[model samples]
Target: MVARRNWAGNVHYAARRFHEPTSVDELRRLVAGSDRLRAAGTGHSFNRFGDTTGDLVSLAGLPPDVTLDRDRSTVTVPAALRYGDLATALHAQGHALANLASLPHISVAGAVATGTHGSGVRNGNLASAVAALELVTADGDLLTLDRDADGDMFAGAVVSLGALGVVTRVTLDVAPAFTLCQYVRLGLAREALDEALDSAYSVSIFTDWRTPLLREVWVKQHAELPPPPAGWLGTTAAETPRHPVAGLSPEHCTPQLGPPGPWHERLPHFRLGFIPSSGDELQSEYHVPRAAGADALAALDEVAHLIAPVLQVCELRAVAADRLWLSPNHGRDSLAIHFTWVGDAAAVTPVVAAVEERLAPFSPRPHWGKVFGLAPAAVAAAWPRYADFLALMVRLDPSGTFRTDLLDRYFPRP
Candidate 1:
């Protein structure tokens, strides 16, 4: 037995043992022997979603087997492979993913499991790229689900929260390689951002919530298109590159200033080898339907005083809707409000609660892997397909082998 903590060091996993299997056969054996277990990837999750009392398994030791199907325009990747590494390899082969999150350090399976996303009105969350997956169930049996063969069930399985089983491999759709350029605008007014939100391929607006204007706006545009508008909402285009969080060296960030680069290099904010975001930070995010965005931000502004002292910065982005049952953007186009806090959980919890309460009227859906203060009842009420997801969980893991305190606490089984 050994002790392990999550990437943020905020969650100390309480597993009786930790296992890293080098092969699917070995992984199956571990799953079959444990009555209660959970799988984690790269420890990127901030909370206890990947913790368990019985055993915690990771597939990092397993060989990364990446294959491309030319006829299908898809690539099959090992669950443990991080997006940065996978993107590099795919780029070498003249292929690319649709979008990437702000950081490229997270595991593919872990990110999809928790509904991690990138910013784009036309782009879906990472899970939406999944075309198929292979997982080991409670009985140690391996099952594969393809989007073509299993429709609705596949939607639920992509954002499974590690409840159904340990995901082993994922098949994702790809497109011909492309190039993009990033441009930064300083201090854009709220109305200006609204007008240009859908003007670019991807847009990210950063703020501290203390002012009516946003601090920075990063717009990623296709190399083939014209540049973004200048002098928007009292904000002007930046001649030099800048980090998402003010004062941080732009060297650590991806290339900017309209220089065309490979899609993988320009899509994310931080470069692959550099540290991503403020290292000493806690993250919390909520997704509300796009129509409620204005009201939601207004509500958060009402509590800006409560949020600022504990916050590093806040980011706003939009995500396209998908059919995934548990996805925050499930059924409605979403506006995501994210916070990077000052790393003091005690000082941040109250603020998190206050934000949740203020946005309750919008029925915001919390990010599964991030810090949240929603009560169990509130959580259960947010997802319209919660009951269907619960039923699916039962069918996949009848013995509750993958259940954890995190799941049981918020979504208790009957």
Candidate 2:
């Protein structure tokens, strides 16, 4: 049998077999009968969180059903649906999601489960929009959890890390479709980041840490908002489109240079169909308190030499805090420091360790789906409600049929 690797081609899944269930009933049956099983969504995660020693199920073949409730301003979609496709459908129906990750190709369920987020001082992570979800549990019984009525338990369930069950459907809050414009500035000084950081709707600063000067600052704004001065932020506007990673063709990137377009199109750095970021890259992100942005940048700057050797690029963004228990942005507004490293794991691991150590003082939370060097104990300790999440997981799946080594490593049965 062929071994299946993840999107980043890093971890090879150890599943004995892979199955694509065409219907919810088929999915439930396959999962119910298996001693060990886990769901795979679009194969976008960089780690073994989705890997299992038993059956590996994909909901891709499931019907892509989308039901809209215009009165309640919500949309119910199959879990396997990719955000990119969902965004297109939502726009056509005159609705939209508040934010999207840097790449739109990820499955909605996977993105929400991993706490994936987009950049915005006011916007919460994608999971924050999940009003409700349905999952097929170990017994073949379908279970539904609502964010509003489920109370504290729902907060932990939203970011399940593939431990609770096979999520089959997700209901998300929607908003009136809107348009945005993207602007880019090149070679801005590090000091300028403080003054210009929260000045825009959604701001991202991209750099490689090779130099003290930042490489790019992407400013996304509402179409109706006035444009900043041409020489705004003391840097020249990019006359043409620019990719986040230097030397790559800007063709893969969305429209830039102040052109107004659908929010779904302009918000993500890469266009839906194009390869996102560098095709050969490993990602690791750490979120620190929003106010700790300067200290975090300085901490990373001290290790620039160690990082630049294996680094592809580093991205900086902010996310508003939410109530989701497992979300990195929980409790406090955060500044996310992301590293897109060259795909060499051996060379990148030490650098990731150094980064974690440097940011340790601030209690940074690592992105769950990406590569990281922190120990399982440290990760659990960082989340105050982690013990509660573990209890919830055990209560939901006592047999541990849906549990993976990844979850067990970080959250063991208490």
Tell me the tens digit of each residue's lDDT in model 2 across 1-414. Answer: 223888778888998988888899998899889999999887778888889999998888888889999998999999989999999999999999999998899999999999999989899999999999999988888999998789898888998888999999999999999999999988888888866667787889999888888999999999899877877777888888898888888998989888899999988998999876545789899999989889888988888999998988899898999999899998999999999999888999899999999999888899899988688888887898988998988888989999888878888899
Best by lDDT: 1
- For candidate 2, which ten residues in a row score worst on lDDT? 1-10
On a 0 to 1 TM-score scale, where does candidate 1 land against the true structure?
A: 0.98
Q: What is the TM-score of each candidate against the true structure?
A: 0.98, 0.97
Candidate 2: TM-score? 0.97
> With candidate 1 superimposed using the best TM-score fit, by how many Å does residue 215's alpha carbon deviate from the native?
1.0
